[model samples]
Target chain A: MAYSGFRLIREALTGHKGWKPAWRDPEPQAHYDVVVVGGGGHGLATAHYLAKNFGKTRIAVLEKGWIGGGNVGRNTTIIRSNYLLPGNEPFYELSLQLWEGLEQDLNYNAMVSQRGIMNLFHTDAQRDAFRRRGNSMILHGSDAELLDREGVKREAPFLNFDNARFPIKGALMHRRGGTVRHDAVAWGYARSADRYGVDIIQNCEVTGFKIENGKIRGVETSRGTIGAEKVGVAVAGSSGKVMSYAGLRLPIESHVLQAFVSEGLKPMIPGVITFGAGHFYVSQSDKGGLVFGGDIDGYNTYAQRGNLPVVEDVCEGGMAIMPMIGRTRLLRMWGGIMDMSMDGSPIIDRTPIEGLYFNGGWCYGGFKATPASGLTFAHLLATGGPHATAEALRFDRFEKGLMIDEKGAGAQPNLH
Target chain B: MIIPHPLLGPRDAQEFVYLGDASLLDRPDWQHPEAGSAYYEYLYLRDNPAGVHRELWFHEQGDRSWLVVTRDTTTHEILSAELASQVALSKEPVR
Candidate 1:
């Protein structure tokens, strides 16, 4: 049933017994027009946009575990479009635009809070780089502001501004960037897709693809064989294993990225703040817990857990900027495997295989790209080409040496 | 996790810097006829297995040696560790 204020009031008067399941748990069908592997945020979003935008009704999203069970549910939940490169900035700006209107469009409360994100700069060179990045954002029609030391102090007075080694110099503030309820994004898309006759089959692991000649006929699954004309795999870290089914290797590595949350306390942080000299970013959740994360564990692993060094290093970064968090008890921490692409950008392109498509290599930034990834993948699946904003996220870019290396880290996936 | 170094005793994992799949040791010749695809595969693609695999880790802060550590990606368990140079020498013929 559609959620509305009138419906809420009537349900409240009737003891709120009128609510139903958020989405349907449908069984796999014999055949579908499109099949999306991995029902994480991107896969669900792809199915949602495929139905809502591209007018493809016969779509099925097969999840090995369940929706929101992967990196979608484990990330720090921060979203932003404060990118520097032309190849990446515009696509993320489009994602930010979609996030702005997501709640109204989905008719589900995804809790997209644009409280802003401030990327702190600690040195003169970093300030100049942020200035150039801000100009690029402005040129891309995205809002960006260069704030001085006083501006940061006015908002966040608790920061360690007088530290000897890395004093606060300035920051680039993107007011449209913030956090969303990450798992709710998956649920919202699942429910929206189910309402439009899309099947969301949980526990249905795709074992292999049923390719005949150059085209796909369907997929082999743990449950049973299901048929589809086109298959798109957005299985995040599993990009390696899943694509191997089609006998194709990818320019991707699976590495573990860990995130941390502190025990709930009184509201302390104002918006998201990232360290310039270190690999740390933090924001306060609605429950008053400080949500934060840092660099991925610099190794190749499919394990959804990291070691102590990265944890200690991230805590050190947190202490370097905001010392108050050092006192707050770290309640819990977890890890998720990121599909670290060679150039640290994402790919939403058709593979050499006729009907098989791929979308992954998000590195450490997949959570923010859910909407755009979905819409663009849906566009590619329905129209047989990438969305205009995501044209540069192609497979051939690597061979052509046109890699969209945002960090300039060269073939180092861990550095990106 | 602790890496049992081939030369040294068990050392803390913090002292090492990870480079990726040990397959990187197989650096293709730059002047090969199909260097384009060879370098592309060598540099980008990875078989990031979910089970036991070998990877390169530089002891940047310890003994300053490179070791190929066989690890299970699912459990983060170190299966074996060997000197990287020894492993490379075992693979290559005398020049």
Candidate 2:
């Protein structure tokens, strides 16, 4: 049912007996026109846009576990488009624009909070770099502002501004960037897609792909063998393992990126604040808990858990910027396997195998790019060409020496 | 995790830079006819084993020496650590 304020009141007056499930759990069909592997935000959003925008009817999204059980549910929930590269700025800007109207479009309360995001700069060189980045953002029709030390103090006064080693010089602020309710995004897309005649089958694990003579056919799953004319794989961290079943090796590595939340307290952080010298970023949730994370564990693994040293290192980075964080007790912590590409960017392209497509290598930017990723993947699947905004994200970019090295960290997955 | 360095005693894993799969050190000869494909396999293809693994770690903070570390990935247990230079020298055949 479409939710509304009047519906809430009516249900309350009627003793709440008219409510129904948000989305139905449907059984998978023996054959479909398109099958999307993995039911995270990207896959569900792909299905939603495919049915709503592309007018494709026979579609199914198969998930090994329940919805919102992957990286979509385990993230810091921050969103932004303040990128410096031409290949990246336009795509992420489109994602931010999609996020702006997401709640109204889905008729679900995804809590797209555009409070703001500030990247703190500590040195003169860093400030210049941020200045260039902010200029790039403005050039791409995205908002950005360079704030001085006093301006940063006005925005967030709790920061250790006068640290002897790494002083807080200024910040780059993007007013349109903020956090969202991560899991709600997956649920909203799933519900909308289901309403448009898309089947969402949960607990159906894809064991292998049924290929014939180097062309796509269907998939072998735990439930049974299902036939599909086209299949799209959007399994975030399992990209490497899943694509191997199709005899395709991915240029991706799976690493565990941990996130943490602290005990609830009074509202302190007004917006997201990222440390300039280290890999620490934090934002306060509506529940008053401080949600934060740092760099991925520097190794290749599919495990969704991390060790204690990285935890200590993340806390150190937090304490380096905001010393008061030492007092708050860590409530809980978890990990998500990141599909880290070589050049610290993502790939949304067709694989060598016909009828098989891949959408992964998100690293730390997956959660923010959900809507645009889905839309672009849908465009690619429908038209058999890359979307205008995602033309540069190709599988052959590395071989062609057109790598979108956003971080300039070279071809190292862990460094990204 | 604490990696017991052969020369520097116990060192935290944070100070070291991680490069996957110590097998990367064995570079294939460029003059070979299949060098192009071999280099591609060396750079992109990796055996991501879920159990025991031998990897490369650079001790950037303490000694600035690259170490070959053998460890169990599932348990995060360090089996052994050695200087990469020594390991490379040991791999060379005597004329």
Q: Among these predicted structures, which one has the highest lDDT?
A: 1
- Residue B59 of model 1, lDDT score: 98
DockQ for each model: 0.82, 0.40
Backbone clashes in model 2, listed as residue pairs: none
Misplaced by over 4 Å in model 2 are A410-416, B2-12, B33-37, B45-53, B59-95
Tens digits of per-residue lDDT for model 1, A165-190: 88998789999999999989999999
User: What fraction of the native alpha-carbon contacts across the interface, defined at 8 angstroms, is recovered by model 2?
Assistant: 0.25
lDDT of 1 by residue, B1-95 (tens): 99999888899888898898999899888877888889888887888777888999999998899999999988989999999999999996421
> What DockQ does model 2 achieve?
0.40
TM-score of each: 0.98, 0.94
lDDT of 1: 0.90
Off by over 4 Å in 1: A410-416, B93-95
Candidate 1's TM-score on the B chain: 0.95
